[model samples]
Target chain A: MIRSITQKKTEEELDQLLTGIARIFIIGCGTCVTMTHTGGTPEVTEIKEKLLKKGKLVTGDLVLPVACDNLTAEVLHENRSKIDLADGLLILTCAFGVQTIARQVKKTTIPGLDTLFIGKETGLGQFDEICTQCGSCILGETGGVCPVTSCHKGLVNGPCGGTKNGKCEIDEKKDCAWTLIYNRLKDLNRLDLMKRYQKPKNFQREPRPGKYWLTPT
Target chain B: MVSLFKKALESKKFVVTSEVAPPKGTNLEKIKHHIELLKNKVDGINITDHQSSVMRYPSLGGALLVKEMGGEPILQMTCRDRNRLALQADLLFAYSRGISNVLCLTGDSILMGDHKEAKGVFDMDSSQLVATIRKLEKGKDLGGNDLDGAVSFCAGAIVTPEANPLEPQLIKFEKKVEAGAEFIQTQAIYDLDLFKHFMEYAEQFPVKVLAGVILLTSAQMARFMNKNVAGVNVPQNLIDELSTAPKGRAIEKGIEIAGRMIKKIRKQKLCTGVHIMAIGREELVPEIMSAAELG
Candidate 1:
């Protein structure tokens, strides 16, 4: 499963953080991060209420779509006076969004959430992080289930023999990665393909940190 | 002519109703189980029309499934997605197929659902939809156009008693009653004190009111709704009670809480009936009624 940083800070933690700060400004993201419930207008409002209870003056709050995008700078520019008046900035966005806003703002900025990896909604109100984005998409040979993405220890080959009755060694309830692979391949009638020796994954082909790409016009 | 639902309200005995959300896919076993469980317990089963703007198996199909299963279905119609023409056509088709009850709603905003890019066709709000139903009963269309055959329904509308600005909801409630709405179902009410206060003011009106009883899953679920869901306040004490339950016993706790509310409402005879919304946990309806000692 993908490991995303789950922000479990309670209202009490927020109150303690904003105790001395007289003026606070809140910034929220509107894209994938916000939809995932890490940061949004609603979450920002909740933080604002906590700060108010702690006697901190919440100057203003705004949600920008794709806070990491250049458009966020324009939104901040439009609300510059509010941003400038604040003693501290609380950014309720992904880590990237927080960094982008911090780079643009002249005031002191802090992140309200630690960014986790990409996840998928398993059910209503239930999210399971399933991808670390390891700079590769290896669904072609793996039957759509990424062993590198899902396994807790990121084991690429067969199970380490620690698995008991298809459950992972790390967690009893979680499925064993090799077991899932066997089942998926068996269902697809491609069990013979698992016997072949596969080449080691090329690290250079994956998306590395500091790498940037722009679409051709 | 006034709706038949208004005529049914003349009876002194209270009525019972429940809602059933059709599965997203073609799974019929769960839906069938719910229908069977609620068959004798409720006077009608309201099949919701794409609740929360999320697409699912069609409401008409679900209603038909209920009809086939020998259950009376109150087909819920929302004006958010369908235009007037489609609305009128569907109503006519429903009436032709012998479906009776119709609950009109303005529906949830399109921005809240998975399909954000989908355009909302709010051709008519709930009030206008009620008025249109009345017009159909008179053998006429919304555009003052004539129809080949007349149609009738036990038309109903929804009200939120816990609205902070109570006057606007009251105004809309009155307008719906005026627009030939014979019955009204309210939004989920967890705070009885507030509900009693709302009833004190609402009782003056002539229409029959059914208090909505939404089954709580957990105290955290209740708290989450209170924090996120608009116009719903589950109260802090209730939240604490739900949160403090022994692990895996939260559902039982929720049922107990719902039963307590139902018993109080029934003992007080506050409203005409209760509309139980168990959400996905419809199997607990019998348990809830049994807990309240209703049946």
Candidate 2:
């Protein structure tokens, strides 16, 4: 539920996508994006306003719940006239949502936001991009702070000597992943837990195309 | 007798208020039940205007319901969807209906709502809306057009006390007061220490301020909102406390935490009042108030 702001395409990039299109329709996803305040209706409206300010012939915009789910096809079917009236579709959703719209519509499709992996909020309006979808989650151990995902250097066993005053070598304000893990374990009075060295993470199922299962089917 | 809110502010006693989100559909039974539960417990009820850009029953309609139910209603208005003409007309209509208190907001982005195809008419931001309200009070429209009759309101606006680069928010705070805002309601404040720091600067101003208190349902819920909701920050320690509660008892724990915060806020007199946003859990408002000994 960490509602990280998705990286958006610059106006120059958007201008290139809509270069010659006479009319463009923007679509936003409501379920996840709206709740996160990232790709929801507000971002779509802001995008539409920005495009209008750029003199683009933007036709209109629409937001659908679970744009990657089957419901999007139904929404597309319902709003087909508006979608068909436009020369191209600008989608403000995750990568899955963009692909879903592409599969459902015949018009040219473009992604307004670059999909990033799930992140956790560290503070207000601040997020730490963790879990590169390494295909595995090891939150049970390590007291919830992911050394593999959160550490910029990805140190699994211990903090590198580069860590100074608990801050990461890569970024000054960011806490070293190992340092945070150490402090958290210490607070729980379980500092000895670090003696159980975890092996280097396996990449077989991560950063690669693979199938996942909720239950054996 | 004068309004309880006016009296409380005049006496410098910490007052308590709460918000009621109108149901999306026409069903008013639940809303009415909530109003009855909170009528004597709180000083006023804020009727949110399509909060988070989601379309629901109008705030004006909810305010009317509050009026009929014998509760003072603070009508919230956002400028995102309405033009000045519509806004002014709505203000006039609200005044005629005996809705005197108002909280002006710039509004959430329309793109955040279910209706993405809806057009946004940001003819004015919150500051301009406050200015517009002032102009109407002066018997003039925004364009110097004279009005047939002047309208009066107990005008207020919102301030995000936790906004980073606090200068801009502070500047806007001063601008709102300059535009004739009589009161200010802050965004949901979790860290009172941070709020104290904000008040250090705010105490110099001449307006009554209200601290917004949002009820936390669960640790996971708090974490979710901290991650997702803008301008809301739930400290990790508070989340941990929420997580430690046994199943089905988290709501009670939340009420306890809110009660504690309210007690501290009242004891310190950090602000003129407290505006509680329980999200959809309006029933627990009285519990928090009673726990804080407000009644």
Candidate 3:
């Protein structure tokens, strides 16, 4: 599950940001961002209408079914003329999607959305952080709970003697991630997994500018 | 050699220790004073590892200083800042430096600290950290590779007797015991009845339990902790006492509250001993012990 986040900026703010550029191309993602209503056909349509009402030209608009996929390159190429018609582009997608599309096209891309964190959809219109994207994965040792994201202190070795009534020390609303992990492991009878001391994470694996590409088949 | 605190754990008598959060900067004068004052009064001095995820002088360095100052040092190791490699190396260093006692804890989240963006390397949970210490004692690393020499430790872990939904905390506590934690220093406790209930189950395990006592300075402090700090509860009476303290004597009232808690824990034989967390009030430990009749 992907976490689709919305920025606090409004239509007026977006209009203010596009001061000079009359003709604009708007792009949104159908997968993650669409779910958040921040980057979808509806959102793109809304922005296009607002721009038209502001007397600016709405050159083109497309909500790529999936913007972060390898196929984004092909999609950008397919929509090249529609995109080239605009003076600039407004990307209502995550950083990953914006950068992915930007690399394929040479047009100046304006990020209309704020990229939040990697998280899971907790409920309808609700999301919570689940993974930190730390280079190394240790959920096996933690009984499938991601302490990196769960603990307020993000303590991997956890609970930190600060939890009260199974809730976090810092946030009373949240369950203590360690306590949850412990209880989960106990229920699974896999508490033995918690016995192994995890060495420090090899952050080098998830260094900044992280990129990966599988060899062509 | 086994540390004196280790001996106390093995013995039936109650054990007493206190925390000394190392300075944020290089100024060691304050910690040095706390250590010197507490050296003879308590069984061990726990050097916290960035206590609330805020960066500070290393616990390993503080443990070494405790050793130098003639205090039994319990080096607290958290999996927050260091990975397994750094953790193992620090353990080896602690053992080599003759700092024997260890308190294994899953450290506080880095978000709670000054550095909000720092990545947490919870490579190991507290249970794993405790088990790792055992592995080191067996002269081997986690990879099953033999070490240059064997290390001996008086290892311990923390427990929250005051935890709501106490079942999960108990589960973790039991896991810590199975992972080789010989002693447990509980989170700060105020309600004695709650601790008594926790101890009823805790006694079945083969581990020592030290009730944690955090010195309450004021009603505001108590309210702040209740709201902000997890696993901590300051009874309304105690808060009222702190509020009514004459002028600047609030600290004295706090001292009395801590001393009184220690006295009751000892009087009731609550568990093993008391682990006093005076927060920044380390100098008042001797007085606390005196009032508790521990001196």
Candidate 4:
């Protein structure tokens, strides 16, 4: 399953973000954030305790099963009185969940975690970014390995001169994406694809602020 | 008209080029001195563009300075700070100013630089940047719009000759050639045997290859590059020789070693030319040239 990988904001940044808010209702997610240990029930309870000790009023807290789902509105309505007593909603979830909750509530929503990337759980607890949704997909030629998201510079033609022993220059532990694609293509007898010249990417296909509709009125 | 650098490459002579890095601030005194010193000695002088992603004086500005000082300037452009529109606009500006030589590079990662938080705008890779240069020469913009004045450049790209798993780097080298790279200035090479092997394969390409020779200041620096810098493998013997240099004279010994390698590369006709990168030690380029018997 695609997961929203995230990391908690620094204590200094969080303090600055919540400087004006005194009374707050904490909300966490039980889905992606829960699995990532970033924003779950225990995290919400811990923040509630920390905020209480910092001389702020923690009106209430709740860990919605799926904070980004349409059912989030009804779950928040169940605890309206507790939520209404707060000046802001401290959302300990991914950007999707935080935005979902913000639209359903009138309270000022503050994100506690930074959404790093939409990734896949590659190992027990390891997540790797799989795709960047670069509308003109080249996976068909790259043997199913997406270089746009994997290569540090997102070079299309081939690997930069920074690859050494199948590792990227940025970090020795990280696998060089081109080497991976090269090996995959070599195994499938498609090494000719490695020699093909990829032209300059057309950024118009997936313009920034990407939007799409399945059925237009 | 072909650039002087291109003419030198075509002349089949043992061409020599050295680089000058722009200072961090507006004080261009140091670079000016380096340019004046190398103007008559080397075939061309290359100006670096925020090398290592550390923000510094612009390479375009430095290249103009080289031009003003009556030297052939090879402008280095990286796909690290500018988007396609900005890159194309800069190329136009560069061409209009008569800076007709360019070296396209896939710059170092922004995370490796001083400004760790700055966004890296790698809108095009080096090969794509080379292709864009070709497109601009044909009187069209990246958007396929007609241009009143088309720009022509003796555009070049870089390759890591000793890059591990050499096939991948070779592939990119070929793509750069296909994209209209007329010459290539390779990554700093310390091992000649490995470079000969790379040249054996690179000879098939139509592009001119200039072997990169970076001056080693000390044994420690060589070891650091071996351990930290990617695709740079300084043989153990070179390190031992640097270590053997009497205290404080390691730089002199380093100069000897660099001169020796350049001499061998020239004697063997390993490639078409040599690009000496005296990183921060531009004054010693003349001495390196002298040591190589090219002076």
Candidate 5:
């Protein structure tokens, strides 16, 4: 399943962010973060205890089915009284959920976790980023391997000098994308495609802050 | 109107080249001294561009300095920090200033350097960068716009001859050659038999190959490279030799080792020439060359 991988922010950063606000209401997601054990029920309860231990009032807390879902607005309304009792909302979810809560709630919203990447759960508690959504996909030529996301340098030509024994230079555990592509193409007897010169990627295809609207037929 | 470095490559008389890394700060004293010392000693001096992804004085500025000091500058342009437009613009500027040689590299990963947080802009890999230079020489840019003035250069790229799973690296090498890389500089090689095998394959390509020789300062550094560096396998015997160096004379011993390798490479006509990399010990290049009997 596609999961939004996230890591909890450091306590020091959270402490600095929550200063000057006493009462706190925590929110957690029951979807992706729940599977990752990052912002599930236990994490929300744990944060509440941590906040209470720091002499802060825990007004209330709950784990919504999907913090990023539109139902977040309705759920916040259902618990409006308890949420209003706090100075701010400590959201223990991905940035998408935190932003959704911030947009719906008038109280100050602080993100308790940082979103790392949108990755697929490859194994038990393991995630691997597969695509960058660069908009101009060349998977057809690269034998289904996305170099944009797989290669550390996002090189389209082939492996850089840093590839050693099919591992990336950044980390020995990470597989080199070009090596994977070479092996795949070599298997398919399409090694000639690897030799083709790939021009500079067209950044204009998907400019930053991308947006699109479907035209009604 | 061939560049001097290009002429040397064509001259086929064991062309010797080295590199000078730009400083991290504004001080040019060290770089200037190195350039002045090496201008007449080597055919061309490559000015490294934020080598190993550590931000430093730009290679363009250092190449200009080499030109100012009457030295042949081979600008080392990497795809780690610049987009296609910036790279083409820098190439134009370098050509306008009489800098003629360029060594195209798909630079080291940014994580390897001090600025671990910086964004790495690999807009074009080293092979594409070589192709871009060839395209620019035809009075056009990558954007397909005509230039008022065309640029010419002795373009080159690097290869890791000892890279594990060497086929992928060889594929990239062939692509670079097909993209018009006139010269090829290899990563530091210690195993001559392995390098000879690489050369046997490289001999099929129509490009001048320069064997890369990095000076080993100490045994610990050698071991560190063998452990930490990718594709740089320092044979255990060489490491033992460095470890056995008498006290503080390891640097001289290292020079002896590097010089001996170069002497052997040259005597055997291993490749077209040797591209010596003294790393931080740029001052010792001439000594190394002397030891190799090239001086």
Candidate 6:
């Protein structure tokens, strides 16, 4: 899943960097990050109002449909004159959106938010990490349960001695990921699948800054 | 080594067991006294593993103490604290130490425990833990690595007959039995008639069933357990009785109630045994047994 995350930066921190700059443009995201109310149109509007109250001129704002999309670059080029009037760009979206905007704009782009993690909403107003972008998938052997991301210790052949009553010994609030995988496999009556000792995860950290491709169509 | 508990399960007579909650500190005097007092009276002594999600001295440590004091220990193992590797390793350790009986549990949610910030490592639930014991007995661990020596255990798991939505619990009960659980202990059960209903469905399985009897020391304790403890429904009548008990005689009343239930369970041969959870009230378990006329 193309998941985004929550913002952690505060308004005051954003204001500190914008010190003497008069006019400021705000940009938000309409997709994934927006799902958490971080970079939505309303949030961008709220920030604009705050900037106006701070005595800084609010040039304009836009909640792009997927702030990381290349189309956002085109939107920035179209509003170049409005952006040029401002000393910097205030980003309410994630790091990807901030960087994307920065690449296209002459003005310094300052991020107003810090991204949290790649997770999905597991319950009403609750988001849980379902994947760690491990670059490889092992859900089939684990009875459709993802152990790498769910487990705190992330043991492939798991259940260290500290586990008590299916709770993680490290962090008691979280469910033991390996325990979950075991139960799921048991219910499916495919417990034999757990017999195969999975080798330590090859995190595929090679070629440091990772990239993915399909053959250029 | 096969435990006396295993022998009791195979016997025709009613069996008895009681639990001991290890102290939060390093003091083992209370545990030693309880073991000395009730060791021979009951079939086995259960040492709780961080029961109710609260961290106490390790149950395994207490189990070793029980063995040292010449008492049979059913090491209570929960899936909350450790992952599979640790679980299997501990089982090996327990087996090596001659602590052979195990009560496998999925454990209470960490949200209910002393450590709220702690993460629950439910790498496996109770059902899975039972299966793991069976696998260990077969000469290999969950990862299929052959061991230097295989282990054997009289494995057990928990059931909550009085759970409000019992169908899910029933499903888990069946799964636990299927996972090679030889005996099943329940959470605190008050209403005998309600327990009878649970037994009606439970009788079809081959596993032994032990009705859990948590001593109701006072009305407040009963109400508190009713509100906080899952699957433990203290009927209004028991609460009413505790409420009317003469001041400072609540323990006597609690013993009388526990005795009455055990007496009835034995008289009717309802199940294989009664697992008494005299939490923090270990000194009074013998009185409960005497009141039941078990001795």
Which candidate tops TM-score?
4
What value does the lDDT take at residue B292 in candidate 3? 84
Q: What is the DockQ of each candidate?
A: 0.01, 0.02, 0.38, 0.84, 0.84, 0.11
After superposing candidate 3, which stretches have Cα over 4 Å from the reference? A1-25, A41-60, A69-75, A85-90, A99-103, A106-122, A129-160, A177-217
Arranged by lDDT with the best first, the candidates are: 5, 4, 3, 6, 2, 1
lDDT of 5 by residue, B168-273 (tens): 8888999999999999999999999999888888999899999999999999999999888889999999989998889998998899999999999999888999
Count of backbone collisions in candidate 4: 0
TM-score of chain A of each: 0.82, 0.84, 0.81, 0.97, 0.96, 0.86
Give me the runs in candidate 4 sitting further than 4 Å from their true place: none
Q: Model 5: which residue pairs collide?
A: none
lDDT of 3 at A158: 44
| lDDT (Cα, 0-100) at B158 in candidate 4 | 98
Interface RMSD of 5: 0.8
lDDT of 5 at B89: 94
lDDT (Cα, tens digit) per residue for candidate 3, span A1-217: 5565656256677767787887888998888888888888888998888778889897788888888889989988888888888888999998888889888888878888887777878988788888878767888788889887887655554456667677776677788887889789889988667554445445578478887768744
CA lDDT scores, all candidates in order = 0.77, 0.78, 0.84, 0.92, 0.93, 0.82
**Per-residue C-alpha lDDT of model 3 across residues B1-295, encoded as one tens digit per residue:** 8789988887888789998989999999999999999998889999999988889999999999999989999999988888888899998888889999999988887778899888877777788888889988999998789999988998889887776667666767887898899999988999999889899999999999999999998888999998877778888988998999998889989888888888898888878898999888889899888878886
Candidate 6 deviant stretches above 4 angstroms = A1-27, A32-36, A45-62, A70-91, A94-217
lDDT of candidate 4 over B1-295, digit per residue (tens)? 5588889989969999999999999998899999989999998899999999999999999999998898999999999999999999999999999898999998989988999999988899999999999999999998899999999999999999888888888888998999999999999999898898899898998989999998999999999999888888889999999999999999999899999999999999999999999998999999999899996
Could you give the DockQ of candidate 1? 0.01
- For B175-269, candidate 2 gives per-residue lDDT tens digits of 67877788899988999999999998988988888998999999988988775565578999899899889998998889999999999998988
Which residue pairs collide in model 1, if any? A1-A150, A2-A129, A2-A130, A4-A116, A5-A116, A135-A206, A135-A207
Clashes of each: 7, 4, 18, 0, 0, 44
**DockQ, candidate no. 2:** 0.02
Better candidate by TM-score, 3 or 5: 5
TM-score of chain B of each: 0.96, 0.96, 0.98, 0.99, 0.98, 0.98
